[model samples]
Target: MASAPQTQSLPLFYKELIPLSRQDHAKYKMRPPETAPFLANVHAVPVTVEEFPMVQRRMPIVFSVGDDAVPLALMGLNEGVNLFVDDEGKLTDNTVYLPAYIRRYPFLLARLQPESEELSLCFDPSVDWIGEFDDGEALFTDGEPSEFTKQIMQFNEQFEQAGQRTAQFVKDLREMDLLMDGEVSIQPEGAPQPFIYRGFQMINEDKLREMRGDQLRKIVQNGMLPLIYAHLMSLSLMRDLFGEQMRSGKMPQPDAGV
Candidate 1:
């Protein structure tokens, strides 16, 4: 039995979100992302368990603090700044891997009703690239999802499933008491003070190392060890991200107390 509808905060870059209904959105169309960088201000994005390996190589992966504790790929060290994005919103380094979370933007699977387990395909209507257009891909045909819409829905569904797996991964970390407070500090060559970052959680190496051999084996067998290592290794990039911020001068100084 489904619960009542729940309201979730919109993800980054989403201004206004509404369910994609055949009736309301039948005339709408979607086109490939335009030149304007929709992610320019987005410094971090959600990451799935499957994305840890690829994302770890390109971005600093960390966990959000508190009960919901989702993994995030940090693109910049501070808020309102994304080191990878240029003034035009295009990625500065095309070769770098983009997290699936960003790639799935503008479309998402959401539970419209709290009691209902069924998810609805939803979109950020404010995304300029998607709207009423005759030349672009239609969202619906004959009041049914068009092929393009179907593809988008499929991707959204996959993202949602990945999100579930990611949630479980976080839960496992919590259950194992493996998560601990994380702090990172970085200073550029000419900077007077190091940028200190906090308010995030990360895997505790000490706890992990102290785990019994059998427990460690279980995690290794489940393929979680590599993911943990990836996250720990990715923390080294905090300095690199700080360097980008210095070079671009896009963000203000890091919070003194953070």
Candidate 2:
């Protein structure tokens, strides 16, 4: 039998993205998608990045109509739960995709507030995840440049933590063997699988390809609320599959994450 798959080494050289928020975040309470309970599958590693305290509080943002403090939260579509929300809000159902490049760059991102009383969330093909905004219905829509949107859309601060935190993320993977594609093959059922082989965390390219479906389902089931990287992917896939789902029917409102 082939040896266990080799784990993909964590890309540790790319952690300086904390300061990239070029936009100020203190100003707005990011809202949930106009509608929600979207699909998603996300995992949270519990390590603290003191330099960037926000890392530990990672969650998808949620917003609702007729409220004042849109919330920021953490949610996995598969879990059917939003880790955090300022208050009650609606979420959209959609799926998304991400570049493998996300592992290198912290999945920094934002879910912009919606415009009108629209019951949908729109997506942009650009790198950042942007929501609909129209002052005709709410505030911050001059078809002009402004900082509010950035507060709702920007990269996250996932890796800025205690030195050992990132090290631990690396160490966890190292302890297990990863299945690299082309290096291994899946054995037929009923065939006795090798021991010391099953336990290794599998990450083979073939396996990665197979897992594509699950990953996509994750995005759809949790599209309403997405993890940093997952949200990034949503905008892309959402565009491809449903652009109408991406836009707001009308512009509208809120704030709250406490």
Candidate 3:
């Protein structure tokens, strides 16, 4: 595997680098009108587990991003991704599982959405475990145990399964980078584990998009988000180098083989 070169640079302005606005760019044409390849066959399903047996919850394995809001499509444990729920009903982990698809090609967590069409992204950050509540079943109501307890059990199962599901996705993600193929040597007994994804790379992509509205358009044209994450820039000079690439499709593809 080829390693990325180290860089030491100063910061630059966003406006100065990726100077091309949507009105002036052409490669910003990656999508047709209605193409949501992210949510193909997934749908929400009940997840029943002992840990959260009295909660009502569903896990979304797939996603459909549009102008209004994206929807999650969660399939069965064997069929699709899982919804990660903390023991306390709070969301501790979340992501998709791609056992086979990612083994062959690189999947960029990118700004692939087009403004002209009703677009959906491949990721979201709004769904997280919000902690647990004993929804009336733990205590009898009107001198009777709530029948809804079964539904609650189903909800908790979904969340627990989601965690198992997300764990696999993180595994698949590490497989995409160059270092993931190496031997497992870095460790210490009982020490806090290091994360597979970190900092900006682990950011809620949906939140990043929400924060960067028009700026994303230019970032797409420049194709700089992934570059920066690969440590190819200083926060200051990102847009300038990104802008140069946007003006010309001659940007070099970094050799980040898995």
Clashes of each: 11, 55, 26
| Candidate 2 lDDT, 1-258, residue by residue in tens | 212112233222222222222132222123333432122222111222231223222332221112121111223211222222212423332222221222222223322222323111112212222223322122133433245443323223233333345344233323332222111122323536511111112123333335456554653474311232332332232112112212322111111111
Worst 10 residues of 2 by lDDT: 249-258
Q: Model 3, 156-250: lDDT tens per residue?
A: 34544554554443333334321111111222235365212111122234444464456666545654345323221122222232233334442
Candidates in order, TM-scores: namely: 0.91, 0.22, 0.20
Candidate 1 weakest lDDT stretch, 10 residues: 249-258
Model 2 scores a C-alpha lDDT of 0.26
Once fitted onto the true fold, the runs of candidate 3 whose alpha carbons sit more than 4 angstroms away are 1-138, 141-145, 178-198, 202-258
What C-alpha lDDT values do all the predictions have? 0.81, 0.26, 0.26
**Candidate 2 ranges with C-alpha deviation above 4 Å:** 1-35, 40-145, 153-168, 172-258
